[model samples]
Target: MTKSIEAMWKEGFVNEACLTAPKINDLYNRKSQNIVDKFKDMFDINIKAVIAGSLIMLIMMSFIGAPFLGIYIFCLLIPLIIIAKMELKKSVNLSKGQSSYDYLMNFNCWLESSIETYSGYYKVFYPLFFLGMAVQGIVSQAGGKLISLLVEVLPTDIIILGQPYYLVVAVVIVTLIFARSAEAIYRWDLNIVYGRQFKKLAELIADMEELRK
Candidate 1:
């Protein structure tokens, strides 16, 4: 009855391979968690840097007679930071007991949504930022003198209603061109900042998927 006993043992006994499934899943969980933790760390640093830079710019602008530029940029960025911080909190609070793959997928979706949201904001902010700089330049001490000099040299045909229509047209055109490419520019900037972390996350997800198969 040895063959019968062997068959019964095979049917009833658990093996090392069976036990390994949970360990493998746990490993994936840890790896996925690490990837997300790294992203959060990077994001936190960026936020702090933005805050410090804004304060520095405000102080420098106050000294240089362009405090409005500093205030304008701060106002534009503060609301964005507030919204992002709230979203970050929500991501961190995702329900427990999710599969590693599902968690990563959720995070990926969140990242894409965040990028799109920021891109929408950039569409308006980028144009206003450029336009504001143009205005700042025109009103600066050196810029005011330079414009006066140019006004004396320019033809009256280009000056309409006592305003330099050509300069206005040039500024608007440049701002429009920059605005048109703002999303691409922001994506490029994001890639530069987070490319390595994003690549690791994708690779980890692929590995987990392959293991499942």
Candidate 2:
């Protein structure tokens, strides 16, 4: 005549009086721990993917004859991995010895904090990334030949820092636009990569909150 945990959970949900305080607390802990464990696994996978992507980018850039740009991007990527690892470390220790509700709350706060931190970095990073690409394009062999063709056909008088003034202005404008849209771009990226995980986390938090009421 012992009830299964699932039956107890259902019974508790239907009529709270059927479950003791310890049983309810244990169920909450189990549910939250399952969600948190899944999140941790996904986070680890995401970090690994980023590290792999950075290596691929470096190799591709080097093969494409943009060693300086490759190095620059590699350096930029290092900090991203570092920051993610740091956040992961913090998350690992975040909810130790805390109740299920408190643990979920801490996780929610950590997610918000992590997103804000990454968004700030991406805001600066996106503009710089575009600018670097622009510089590499203009200084490449093809760019030199194209410049020569333009010089033959168009007026060579419109120069700024030995480059075409219009080209410089265009690069600057494009970079500015990217900077302005960086947050939206980051959100889009996040949605593409981890939208389901985030949705599940939000739902788990909401359920926990409702259970506490």
Candidate 3:
């Protein structure tokens, strides 16, 4: 005919939890949607970045070649294009997953791979990029405008060693310089381009983990 005070409080607590469950789920759901928006925007940015890189590479190609430089620039661009495609796939895969937590975890990993990919590319791109310039210097030094201008300006031979071999030595020196500098340059570029998105994705992953718990 009557309930105890303890029983009443327990029943009220259970009722509140039951009533609030859907709202709780809805709140967590917003986290996933927000993550999706951030990642989609990131994907678009990556696409634009790749296109811009391609244009710059094309411009460089117009000037960079003694054949060796042209070939090297072409080779260097292939990995960048591949990374761009992979980034797009990551966004598309997460676009409409059923569970927020699932996609957030996936996105966290995707971000990690992106960093790894760029770091790996760094170890490759910087040296090769400068190699094109070195080759141009070598090819143009003999009879091109640079040499002609030097003759007109009043100078002696600038050869540090023999002709062809000296130029080869210069190329080796340029390659070594960029090899040492690659990590710093790569990190700088990475910070500029993807730093904000990486941090946001990590935070979303953390929030999703906490919410699921």
For each candidate in turn, the TM-score is 0.84, 0.83, 0.64
Q: What tens-digit string does per-residue lDDT give for candidate 3 at 125-201?
A: 88978876655664664545664564466555555544444445667887998898888888888778768866776
Per residue, candidate 2 scores C-alpha lDDT tens digits across 1-213 of: 897766555556445455544577677778778878887888899899889988998999889889899888888878888888988888898855866778878888988898898899899889998988888878999988887787777766789977877778888999999999999999999899778878877887787666554
| lDDT per residue (tens digit) for residues 1-213 in model 1 | 344643333322223134434555566678888888899888888878878887887889888889999898878778667766866776787654676677888888887887788788888778888988888998788887887888789855676434588888888899998899889988899899999988998898777665554
The residue-level lDDT of candidate 1 at 58 comes to 83
Estimate the overall C-alpha local distance difference test score of candidate 1.
Answer: 0.77
Each prediction's number of clashing residue pairs = 0, 0, 0
* Regions of candidate 3 where Cα sits further than 4 Å from its true position: 1-21, 59-74, 94-98, 141-170, 180-184, 210-213
Give the distance in Å from residue 210's predicted Cα in candidate 1 to where it truly belongs.
2.1
Predicted model with the maximum lDDT: 2
- Among all windows of ten consecutive residues in candidate 2, which has the lowest summed lDDT? 13-22
Each model's lDDT comes to 0.77, 0.81, 0.65
User: What ranking emerges by lDDT with the best candidate at the front?
Assistant: 2, 1, 3
RMSD of each: 5.9, 4.3, 7.0
Local error of candidate 1 at residue 23 (angstroms): 3.7
